[model samples]
Target: EVKAIHYHPENTICDCCQCQMTEIGTTIVREEAEFIPARMEKVQHIEHAYECKNCKADLSQKAQIKRGKSPQPPIQRSIAGPSVLAKVIYDKFVQYLPLYRQVKEWERYGLNTNDKNLSNWVIRASHDWLLPIYERMKNIMLEKSILHVDETYGQIINRSDGKSGQSNAYNWVYRSVPCQGPTIVLFQSSLSRARSVLEGFIEDYSGTIVCDGYSAYDKIEGITFANCWAHVRRYWLKADSKNGRIGVKYCDELFRLEREFKHLSPSKRRKKRQKHSKPLVDEFLAWVENSPFYGKNALAKAAEYTLNRANGLKAFLDDGRIEIDNNPAENAIRPNVIGRKNWLFSVSEAGAKANAICLSIAETAKANGVDFYQYLVKLLRDLPNLDIHRNPEIINNYLPWSKTIQAECVK
Candidate 1:
């Protein structure tokens, strides 16, 4: 319970009747919804200096002054304590509460904090502590042989630090396939949805990528691409066909077989697909080449989409480890897209990068069964003291999927 209170009526004169009223047993005990103000406090750190008397007595030498050491502030020169800073970071990143909205909440509770100060705290924390963990997650995620890639638009402020004039930017997401060891999701913020962005992010990634019909994913060399069946269905489902029966039926059939194959081992699933799915695909392609829906209408568009992406759409038949769709990447980034509607925009590239780092860590932790709140609290409180630049190997222990984090953070 947050708190409790008792009420008692007094014996006093009635307001309008001007008569003495006697206290008696309660007729109705009322308990309604209420709230208690958040507990906020102010703290100060003072460093005391001491000088050696022997050193001071030597006039030819400079006085030796030693200052007592204190732990570094959560953000250098910021008054926000670790817990307070951690709460705000969690609120903005995980809960999707915008900084201005948080400012309003704090003002209602009578605190003097503002958005600028809170944003600075978040910026410092992201750059100083979280990016190393994010990079480590990137390295770990790339090791998977099969991954999913997807992109969603994120709004950034106009002329963001003069980095770009574009109002909308890309939040590219990549994640490992299900039933794979230690699931992870990684997000990268970019000024443009260029092919180079994916290339640079992938570096030398030589694995299967399950994605949609985007031309950008096609440019990345030396990687097998498995396209999403959902994209194919969306086109056919949206197309207003005069007789809504034939062209899109194959997509439905494939999905039905997938549902049955889900519980089977990958090798068994692959053999099943080869035996059952391949013939249906052959018939579908033959129909597409000879069908009457060959005009440039919606039906034609649907067929053309499949025919154009035939290789990618059918690549899943070759490997059981590859999921038939890019749904995992889409599902992981869906919350970030929803939160974008509330927070609306990032003011600078620094803030956009910060947003990506926080969302990546939070979602990845949650995907692997770790509670994001506790994980982030531990990160904010402890990560500041590590000397990562000097000893890069120290970051391996801090990764979300590492043995230490798995033991401590997994729910």
Candidate 2:
């Protein structure tokens, strides 16, 4: 498709001939992209009803009336539609736009709606439609053998636990390793960052968990912790001493070896690490144990931290599927962290949970190369029609990696 730029009648005349100039053909001078600002329009549905004439003619007989099937609104008793709700979710979760700001954006589009109405739409949609999908994602994610876990701070303004709402809260993120399968990033909002939080999320599960040197992950039964080497390097990086430099060197060498073996098959990668990385690991641990610094110094602190979690740091050697760092989980959780900076805090605990659900869907869709807005639109439009709660398996068809979903939602 092509668009023509029109000139004024006076300008269309040829200056040299003083005659009218006509377009013989078009020239491909240049090409550029254009953005059209979005505008809103009102949509009204008028369902037609039909009645049997014969039955109507017989006054004693009841008339058979049939009504046309109308499409359901994404949210009942609200003006919001599937596309509208998708935009709100996309702006707030993906673009990090807050509700008050989005209210202003709606005004620009000639729709005057307050932040309270927007919040209600999101909360109701998440509770009614999105929560089922979130749960299904969680169940499938936990089925994978290799998982990465991390957490960051979150706040809520209304308390449910009888404590001040201003008190601290946390958002825990768990994701399946990319190598294992289609990545699933799930977020959980909780009042505590205790080990119990993680334990409850992965109940009765047994697998490798790659994570930072957080003590809360220490000795959870049936779980193997592959502690992050990058975290260990951070301690050494902060230590302002000659030995600290040596510690960093050891870490760097191990990382370099991992990068070289990145393209190898898991079994082959395991072989390469055992042959090359194991020696460096042994040597680095020896250096940390024998370091001269002690008591209140950076070097001592680094060594103590290293030796304490030495086993977990070495756990990656036995399995190639586990990464040398928890960077995947960190990168996954960073969106929420960045959004937290903009939105500030959830108005209530329920709102925080809704935030987690929305973020999970958006991030999971992104990991699978699906357009976030399109995927949300798909879910919001389709899920309402399915008996998702009774037949939970129906959600499997709509997951980010499903064949139909990939074809439909990936851009």
Candidate 3:
């Protein structure tokens, strides 16, 4: 319920005047200005008339004003500044917000805006302003000694086939040198084939790639694959749900190994695996080889799981450089999945590409220990004047790993 408070002026006698002073009324003043409708009035022009009486002729002169070129009206309708616009775009595309809902929220505030304009701004700004940062991030990722690669399905509308139904697409994210910063995310669209996207992104990247058993990653040449232990354990947990006793034993063993892994830092974990975990891995392998667990009805499942992922599991034991899981890549891709729930799908190929670029910057900023909002604002403000070839430092500043340079210098 809304309530109004009224204040009445108190009547007092002026001692100096020796008369009663009646307070006629009271006025209320507001501390802050309130919003009022814009007042627009039509302007009128009047001409002055002059007469020359000496020449017996009446002359009328019209006012002729010298006018310069009219300045273009500012875009007053925008409640958000360029920085705010960049942030909103990042939140909507990288963070994910449906346009229709954003429109409704703006309407509630007495500001009228359409989702179409916002979408166009996001796409145009991402392609024109943010694409360089995205490219540089990918290049940095390729330079890393270790990387994780993964792909997830992305739905799209208005595909090339002219079909009304949604199309199956993919977002491929790659991160390099994740521990030391400057992580990168690369997104690409593919029908179903993962090899093409992975191969294309990591064409020159030859190093350890941690991934799941997607089979499509097999096509990459000279690249060592380190399988995720989480995937392996997931299978064991599933099997335990059906076959109780055997499943429980395997799950307990895997859980114990993971607990050991959690106690070490990323770098220390790698070294500890070589020291203490190697012996355990050897014993586990020998047990698998000798036990009936590999000979029963579950033999095929156990064999396939052990044989295919044996190298990946042992890689950590042999070299302290490999990770036990492909969690970094999965963590990077998680945001895109959550965003899909809100925005649903991209309208076109271009829109998807834009979404990928914005997400790359946001995620990379976070990885580099930079604020996403501040970094995005800098991108929007400085990108228009940025010359990528000559002014490569601008690109470097946005890289997650490149932090020696000061923020003031980039601006």
Best by TM-score: 2
Q: What are the per-residue Cα lDDT tens digits for candidate 1 across 332-382?
A: 889788889888888877888988998988888888778777777777767
RMSD of each: 5.3, 2.1, 9.8
Sliding window of 10 residues with minimal summed lDDT for model 3? 69-78
2 or 3, which is superior by TM-score? Answer: 2
lDDT of each: 0.82, 0.90, 0.66
- Candidate order by decreasing lDDT: 2, 1, 3
Number of the top-ranking candidate, with lDDT as the measure: 2
Across 1-411, the per-residue lDDT of candidate 2 in tens digits comes to 666664445477888988888877756667677778999999888899999999999999899999998777678889899999999989999999999899999999988899889998999999888888888888888888889999999899887887787788999999998788899999999998898899999998888899988888888888899999999999999997788899999999999998999998888999999999999999989877776768987888899889999999999899989899999999999999999999999998888999999999999999999998998899889988878878888989999899979999998
Model 3, residue 281: displacement in angstroms?
A: 2.1
Better of 1 and 2 by lDDT: 2
Using TM-score as the yardstick, the better of models 1 and 2 is 2
For each of the candidates, give the backbone clash count: 0, 0, 2
The CA root-mean-square deviation of candidate 2, after full C-alpha superposition on the true structure, stands at 2.1
